[model samples]
Target: MYTFKFIPRENIAQIIPFLQILDVNIPAETLEQRLNEMFDNNYKCVGAYHEDRLIGVSGLWILTKYYIGRHIEPDNVIIHPDYRSRNVGDQMVDWIHAYGKANGCVASELNCYTGNTRGQKFWSSQGYEIKAFHYRKMLDNEL
Candidate 1:
């Protein structure tokens, strides 16, 4: 089993180049801004590194209803293409689930593009159900 460590945003600069190699295209300035916001907002961000190279990232955000609330939620999950098929995604998700459980979340939600069959299958295999369906149409702004 490969060891996974949760690195903080302070070290995120070191991972940006690796994440870029994975085709993650967010600008460094944008990423820095986001990282600062996450830290200031008390959210948790984790990166999985192997031998000083970041191979995966999971961004988590806690959600609440104000009246009725959940303690934890995961916002994003991505594993480098080269690291796929080795169970890194599964392990990272499992870790996030455990974090939610520990924080008393009743449920966790993740949004994936409708046409991403691989993502749908993966989430299904991980025991997530299709609880809701949404349809949208662009009203305008086509150029």
Candidate 2:
């Protein structure tokens, strides 16, 4: 069994390892910079812990968009290899969904990498449906 907690901004460093698990090309310093920006905008992270060890984490953002109204966005969700196949992701999503409803969110939106078929299936299992393709354009590139 595992327990869950809201990892605070001050402890954001604890999420670096998990984020690396999601994307190793990004440098730690880069991830830290982005985390700082996201946190400033009220980003929150829910972590799944097993005996005081963080085994999984998912970042959440609650915001309003004219298209979707108020919604929550899940970003770079990852479960440690040793912890996958267990319900760590589910628990984190469950906690986040409940949080969104409590905070007035009406929907959830996220961008999963097109090549991450496993991740896509997991999201679909959780009732997420593909609405549109995510497009991106890099401005400066270097982080």
Candidate 3:
């Protein structure tokens, strides 16, 4: 069995290695900068552990937007490759759902990359529906 808990910001680095499962390939310095920025933005990460080993992580943000009232947005969800098909994702998501409810979140939202078909199926199984496309443009960087 796995256990879930929110990882405190001070120990956020623990999730860094697990990020490799998501194909995170960036300079160490840049990744550190971005992670610190996320920490400053109140990003909360939940970790799924087996005894003493961290096996999964998912980032979350509880925000109140005009359209969604209050919602929990999940991002960077990745399970360790070694533990992928053992229900770790399901339990981690369930933990997030319960956390959101306790924090008064009215909805949950997430975006799965187009090429990640497995991720899409997992989210669908977790009761998420695709409502709209998330479009982005580089406003300050070269395309």
Candidate 4:
């Protein structure tokens, strides 16, 4: 049986390994700091657990944007590779939607990498529509 719960600050260390599986290039040392900063803002995270182990995670950013009005932006959704195709992702997404609605969000939004067709399909199946293109330019050196 899998249990879902809001992950707290002290327990964040337990999520590092699972997050690394989503983006292996992320520096483990810096991730905690960044996550802490985000948590201080409007960022929220939920985790799916099988007993004491984390098996899936999702993040949400509560924001008020001009175009979307007040909405919940879901990000960094990842399920353990071993647990794919078992509707775990769907359940996590469903939880996100319900959470957003309960919080009075007008809508839910997210961005997926253009090359991730599988992710795109999954989001589409969850009733998310493609509304805009997300472009990014790294500012690490310029800043």
Best by lDDT: 2
What's the residue-level lDDT of 97 in candidate 1? 82
lDDT of the candidates, in the order given: 0.72, 0.90, 0.86, 0.84
Which is superior by TM-score, 3 or 4? 3
Model 3 residue 132 lDDT score: 91
Winner by TM-score between candidate 3 and candidate 2: 2
Better of 2 and 4 by lDDT: 2
Order the numbered candidates by lDDT, best leading.
2, 3, 4, 1
**Which ten-residue region of model 2 has the weakest summed lDDT?**
134-143
Candidate 4 TM-score versus the reference: 0.91
> Which digits, one per residue and each the tens of the lDDT, describe model 3 over residues 1-143?
89988888778678778665566565555656777899899888888999999888999999998988899988989998899899999988888988999999989998898889999999999999999998898897532
lDDT of 4 by residue, 1-143 (tens): 67788899787787788778767788887788888998898778899877887888888888889988888887888889988898888888778878888988999899998988999999999999998999889979531
| All candidates in order of TM-score, best leading | 2, 3, 4, 1
Clashing pairs in 4: none
**TM-score (all chains, Cα) for each model:** 0.75, 0.94, 0.92, 0.91
Model 1 lDDT, residue 107, Cα: 76
Count clashes in each candidate, considering only residues at least 3 apart in sequence or on different chains: 0, 0, 0, 0
Cand. 2 TM to true fold: 0.94
